[model samples]
Target: MILPFILVLALFDFDNVLLWTHEISLVSHKIWFCDAIDIFYYLNTRLFLLFFYFYCLLPPSTQPQRKNSNSKMATLAKLLSSICVCVIVMLTTKAVEATPTYTATHCTNTTTYAPNSTFQTNLDILLYYFSNNISQSNGYFLGITGFNSVNAVGGLFLCRGDVATTVCNQCLTTAIKEIRQHCPNQTEALIWYDECLVHYTNRYFAVDKIDPRVNLNDGNIVSSVDLGRFNQSLHGLLNDLATEASGSSESKKFAAGEVVVTESMTVYGLMQCTNDLTNSECGTCLKNAIGTIPNGKQGARALLPSCNVRYQLYPFFTSSSPSSSGGMKLGPGTIAVVVVVPIFFLIILFLGCYYFKRRSKKKILLPSIMENFGDEFPTLESLQFNLATLEAATNQFSLANKIGSGGFGEVYKGVLLDSRQIAVKKLSKTSGQGTIEFKNEIVLIAKLQHRNLVTLYGFCSEEQEKMLVYEYVLNKSLDYFLFDPHKERVLSWRERYNIIGGIARGIHYLHDQSRLKVIHRDLKPSNILLDKNMNPKISDFGMAKMIDIDEHQGNTKRIAGTYGYMSSEYAMHGHYSEKSDVFSFGVIIIEIISAKRNALSLHSLDFDDLLSYAWKNWRDEKSLEILDSNIEKSYSYIEVIRCIQIGLLCVQQNPDDRPTMERIVSYLSNVSVELPLPQEPGGFMGNRTNQIPRDNISDQRNNSNTTGSSVNDITMNNSFPR
Candidate 1:
């Protein structure tokens, strides 16, 4: 075609032939070619063909043989057609090579290496190891190579939660091959397939990374009669799955389940994390992933380095081996007669009846609960546990089950009949204030729901006994880790930073998102529970207060809270607010960073308290020094300094000087935000001469003489009585 077009242009004029030839060359080179080099190759080949036709078949200077010219033109057309067919075949093959089963890929553009370079060589070995060895396991593998940090390569691959060994192996093989092809010489790469994910990096990346995640929506809108109900059910199902998946063993961190969105509809969900991540890390990653789910979508998935979560109206995961019809494949007649048509409605009826029955019981308990307290009561009857059941679960309040005790009472580790674990807080009958606080905790936590907050399983109130059942956190409290010299090593700077963020999110939920505006009166390290994965959940709401959503502050005549964590106004004049929680959060932040208690003895003359020490360091521009030595060089320097400044801001003597939970969250999340200088914190007694005993100071604020400190208030010195 090009040869004929050039000949026609030449018949018009030699200049016209040259102009048309240049125009075709320019367009074809720019639009048809893949690269500059490819364009040059295409242009040179086309030009050569044109040169051969003009010079050999029919010269422009002398053209007389008509029959010969016609034959040559016919031959040129056949040759060009053959070339076009070959080019199309080659392009198709390249496209096929590029396509993979994976949904997304992350190849680092910032870092690339030469072919067969040291880093590339190490990466290739790691990839080969993963591809060959990952399939040998149930569904997980981690590999590392290189003798030094610079040349080191660490990578991991995880199959979807419910896939079998064979399917996992196949997916792993595909992922390994595809990632290497996609990333080529890049030092870092990640690829996610529906069945598995593969990741590799030069730096150590076994720890959880929340940001730089991939979010995908199926784009199919949920045609639900009640969108709100569907969303609620979806989130609830995902949350439950996250909890289950995060708590899974190190070898397998995966969970999948289905929840009824309505009487006739069900949403299937799945959550999984890299086996190497801690339960808390998995939980955090899943929670972050869940948060990114866009509204009005019927199905969505978010993939992070450590964890991923997915929810869909249709089943996307295989329950058994992939060979078994790939997924939950069902026939139309079977589906209509069985699960969806008949059983679904029956399940809804059963659940509705059960819900109403529980609600009725809660109503019965409400009057009794409010009779003496004379305050508004939340719906607590549903959370009620049988007194006998709890007694049995805790071995009739046996000494062997007791975990800790405080102003509220003793906490016992209890196992329910179904094998579920719980932390049972039995309020002391001797302490009248404990009863009030118990009532307070029941109302506050029942209405609040956040991943960072400890779950209130149920309560038991029968005769003289009142007990609160909470989801048992396996690793106990942050203080157990932060205060113990030997255990402190486990609390890495990354983990500590995560804990700080989790605590911040929990408090923010209490202040802003919860149905009630709550102030967690005792926000301290001991009050923060760490799950198996070292994720922090704020607990002990016994001292918490509930106020109107519009109300900014509250005044309490009976100030009952820990000394070091209490804000100045709340401690000195019984004034409390969300800002008060912020102050305690500040103190907790300093403790988390420094691994030092705020109530440290001043006898050493080094520092009066954690706050004073933090403030001094920040003022001196030596904020990094305030970080716990256990963290060493692993910490993000800017994040540590920002936290220090934020902590100081929260503990400022004047309540007005403090940032709200909303602002604090923004500050913590956005690194670009500039922070104002912090004023001196409360109880900044400067030196040993002015330092006061925290116990005396606390006693002065609340002289109720509660028999024992709260379970959280019990330091290592306070041993449990046998």
Candidate 2:
């Protein structure tokens, strides 16, 4: 074909028609004349080629030339039409792909209910309300109904961080209707759309949840060239977004950003959570979501009830106008290589060798010892402190600087270069915590933020040393005042009441408000610290366990908590949950009221424990006996009685009978709410009969002794108060 076209041009040039020179000036110079010549020239060439090729294939037959010409023309026309149709289809498909599509839907099978059941009705109503609120207001809303009824429904919804309010509302409204169709009459359902999420249940749904989660992988693996570098950039980008989003205000918890993955490619990411969740909750939720992102996937999304995380190669978040300030966005820029390639590799090699050497020495790997610790805290480098700085502040951890000790480490009061007073927890060399607990306290407490919770400033790990830095509480722990005869007398009724409410709010943060649902297994009076103002701050989370917000309870073989504070089921069978924390809180409340330890024997020989003694006195209509004699006689009798009633309800033998932290906070703040009658306390009279040898008991009070392995630790069942 090339040769023939060249020959035609050569023939035109030989005839002096190529340049339309003076010899061709005699011909009309109309534009249509040239066009006609160009068309005829190409058609004549093609016709000649076709005729020659067919002639070579066919026998020299006498009269079929005209018929063959018509057939060839028809074949050419059909091919051109097919090409046009394919182009049209391709354009249409690309248009559809540009729009968002529903990702997934998860409907729990265990929560199946009747079509018209009260629970289902409540769920529908609540979802509708959420939809309405989301449509009219911003892109996030939480709805909860039927507080005390059997058909209680609690839920929340969130839209993409960068989506427009109108689009978010439309997405949520569509999801609400679609969820019902997909999981008809289900008591609990969670549905996800590309733009928003719709979730509701018959029970209260807290922010941190992992189950029924949906993981969507784009399945496009990254290219091997620069794969490691790309992954490193992607992770750094997502982690920054997660932190920023979680730390955002309750009104808007969303972040979006992009990172230069390669010279020609950029990775985009977006993270968002329901505004109802706390900063820590949002962080934890996003961390969990990010953890579920499939390895090597170019694009992916992990959806949960409270949060959503996504990453892709192309920009998916809509650009917001300057007025909206809709979401956090990472500014575009090239990621500078801070470390040399060879040096980076050497660092990794050294770290790997160090880790292996520790393992060879029988030291537990931090990740191996704690389940889900990585998910709870994905990065700790930002919070790490220098051991040298801490030593200088604490005067080389001298005995003079020693303020307290606990099952995990020794506490030393330190003064920073800036004259900031801080408490340093130096992990004992032979302590059972090792790397796991040392990391746990740092990760967990650093994320939790509440006025009633001790603040974690930072942590240190250097030269075979691990220490946690905390804000020092000047007034010491609650036991300093509550148990001492002289100090106990100074704790007036007002102070005691304030202390109780503070403790309740702190525990409430742990159980419900914080990013993760945590059970502080050891909730004794000594574990509560007092500020300069005598306000209580919950401390010592070494024995704490983080669970899913929706989880009812958990079990462990090793029980590590105060005997009097441990619930009956937890003490004997290792069963625990938020309810276990409630039971412990109940014991603390009783101790606070009476100024007497729950496990210690009282003057009366009729009861073996304070729980039993408190129950007997309350049953006999002598609730005043449960109050501390140190309290002024002019105290509010109604408030004291109500507190006693609530404390008993919390100590119910059945964990289910115990009220939640939310309800406990309400009970403490609102006196008009009627308290339920107390049931027999857990392990009321069975302690004496089931008492184990006291020799195995190890006292953790006043921060004494370092914690050992969970299974090796002294069981609380064998440890009773003297």
Native-referenced Cα lDDT, model 1: 0.71
Q: Write the per-residue lDDT of candidate 1 for residues 1-722, one digit (tens) a residue.
A: 57655553443342322211111222123211133233333334434444455555444323444457666555544444444443344334333232325788887888788874556656755665575577466788876766454777788888887765666777788888888788788888889998889998887774446565788998778775768888888878888998999898657888898888777677889998888888988888888888888987878988887788888877666554222112234466644444343234335434545565566677886676676335534455677887866765566677767777665567887655444668888878876766776777777777778889988887877877888888888776787777765563467888888898899999999999888888888887777888877788888787788889899999887667765677667766688899889988998888888887775332346654678878887888888777777687687888888988999999998889999999999999999999999998875334455444454343322222322233336432221211
Deviating ranges (above 4 Å) for candidate 1: 1-368, 372-378, 486-489, 600-607, 684-722
* Ten contiguous residues with the weakest lDDT in model 2: 713-722
Q: Give the TM-score of candidate 1.
A: 0.46
CA lDDT of each prediction against the hidden true structure? 0.71, 0.69
Clashes of 2: 5
With candidate 1 superimposed using the best TM-score fit, by how many Å does residue 15's alpha carbon deviate from the native? Answer: 99
